[model samples]
Target: MTDTIRQRAEAALAEVEQVSAVVLAEPTDANAIVPLKDADKPVGAEITKRMAEIDMSDTQSIVSFGSNAQAELQEISQSMLQGVRNKDVGPAGDSLRGIVSTIRGFSVSELDVRRKRSWWETLLGKAAPFAQFTARFETVQNQIDKITEDLLSHEHTLLKDIKSLDILYDKTLNFYDELALYIAAGEEKLSILDETDIPAAEAEVEKAPEGDQVMKAQELRDLRAARDDLERRVHDLKLTRQVTMQSLPSIRLVQENDKSLVTKINSTLVNTVPLWETQLAQAVTIQRSAEAASAVRDANDLTNELLTANAKNLRESNKVIREEMERGVFDIEAVKQANADLIGTIEESLAIADEGKARRAAAEEELKKMEAELRDTLAAAKSRRDGVGDNAGTAVPGA
Candidate 1:
């Protein structure tokens, strides 16, 4: 009986060592569980079956914890996407109002309303000629304002998306940390089982049954108890190892997800945001040029109308002067002053027209520069995409 018991204890110890060796073997891949070799499969299956029979709560708890974490990660990912969609940087209406105010204040006189008004005009509470100016430029201002609002909206969307990406990155890193710690704890437990618990149990078995029949029988019972404890520890360690192996695929999945999201966010920041900004700036320049041209056109039309009215009045007055000369009466100074005023108005209108032409030319050049920048940015982005290839990195199994 003693010999048989010793043989059985030795067999159990050997089995424990075999399972420990299999469990502790280095994995072939970082992102996946190592596939068992033909020789290892039977032992691996046996360990898995025994673990299931024992119903190891620690192993189940770890799996359950990982499952809950994965589900939460999914929820966070969805929330991040929804948050990007739902987040508002600010109301376009407020920005639109500000743009309109800016347009209202934009002037050749550097927006100084006081410079356009004299002390006498202030004392008389006379409003500056802003009403007529706005009336003439309202259509162009409205178009510019609309474009400005659109640009602001795009900026807001980009900010929200970037914020969402940041949140997702943080959650992914936290999940990775937790998985690493769990894997480490499981590995440690397996190590303790192999190095300490199994060895101690084997020693106890070897030391048992060295006395008389009665004492030997008692020692044998203690040895059996020790063997049972060792068996349970081995089972628990096997289950922990299995759980850790199973978790690798999920960990890899999250890691890949994180990598993909980071790549996408970087692409948006590098390519999309800058492209939109360039387009917005170009639009603003075009609108400004149009506004300037419209102001010039309005000024020219007003100048022509005043000139025509003045010429008609002068002709009527000269006809009256000729009739008065026939009756011996005339005022030549008034005629001279009217001619001077007309020349000054024509010169001012021509100066405004020249300024508008210069502004339009500058705006056109700026637009061409913006277009070149956009093309360069797009080409660079495409080149980067191509260099990265279809798979950004090694394809992780089960990811």
Candidate 2:
């Protein structure tokens, strides 16, 4: 039965790994390349209207993350200044003067187009959402850490209490042994003192001049002292034992509480687990809840990635459109003016694209939910199979 459970756990882990790999690979549908999705329609219309409203030239360029345009700008500025310096150094440098003038013209014009700013500037505009994500991640991590610390502390206290109880138990047993021995010795001493000596029986030992009488008196005194010491030790041991036994209830409670906390933390650390449990029988539920939440988060991340990737692809396509129209062979003004209409068309196309994306996303989410349900079903089936196998194996042969 244990082996069967181990096998199932390994299989589940393998499935989880496979799902993670799928996520990392960033799989996309060829269908996404042509957006026309139901969700895209309104977005496209909004985009078209937005483009129509804005002065086309005033639109900001979409800079990719971590681009190096700022450094390039600096280099261009320095080169232009160096050219001017060289031209001023010699009369034979008229060609250099012309080059310097041209370089300055290009640099100043490029600087005026703010679209060529650093990638950091673009990201700064979206700082609020980024910060929110960071805060949430931090909160989750801190909670996990706190639960872990609590579990460790509870376990430590329980262990310490248990050790104290064990020591106390040993002392109690030793004292009980000492008490039994003392009682036995006292009874013997009392017996000897109480027994009367016949005068004729003493007459024979009396020839030794009463030495026997003195020794007997001394023996009685020593036995009484020894008995007293043993009795006192036994009494102290009994008190210690009683105190230790009293602590047992509280100690057991502490142990139970620690075990409960450990179970809760283990379950809570997972995504599917519930937050509230009464220490016992609550851990499993919490574990399941945490798992479910994790599954949901995974699904959300996958969809978000796919959408973000599609957005990036659309932006790239727009750039390609711009570059193709700018080929030197065409009328520059006509090509430049065409950017306006192209923007509107792209917006409309994007709206169409967004709608299809929405539908696909909905389908993808449904599929994810079904996948989770399928896993549950598989787990249940495996459990049943193992149980049946165990019963069959345990049955008496030919009986």
Whole-model lDDT, candidate 1?
0.50
Task: List, residue by residue over 231-334, the lDDT tens digit for candidate 1.
Answer: 55445544654665555455445444434443433333334444544554564565566667767887899999999999999999999988867752446787
Q: Over the stretch 289-348, how does candidate 2's per-residue lDDT look in tens digits? A: 655676688799999999999999999999999998878776779887899889999999
Maximum-lDDT candidate: 1
Model 2 regions lying over 4 Å from their true place: 1-208, 270-399
Please give the range of 10 consecutive residues that has the lowest summed lDDT in model 1. 18-27
Candidate 2 lDDT score at position 32: 23
Off by over 4 Å in 1: 1-214, 297-399
Candidate 2: worst 10 consecutive residues by lDDT? Answer: 61-70
In model 2, the Cα lDDT at residue 310 comes to 100
lDDT of 2: 0.42
| Total residue pair clashes for candidate 1 | 0
Instruction: Tell me the deviation in Å of residue 91 in model 2.
Output: 81
TM-scores, one per candidate = 0.28, 0.26
Tell me how far the alpha carbon of residue 78 in candidate 2 is from the true structure, in angstroms, after superposition: 76
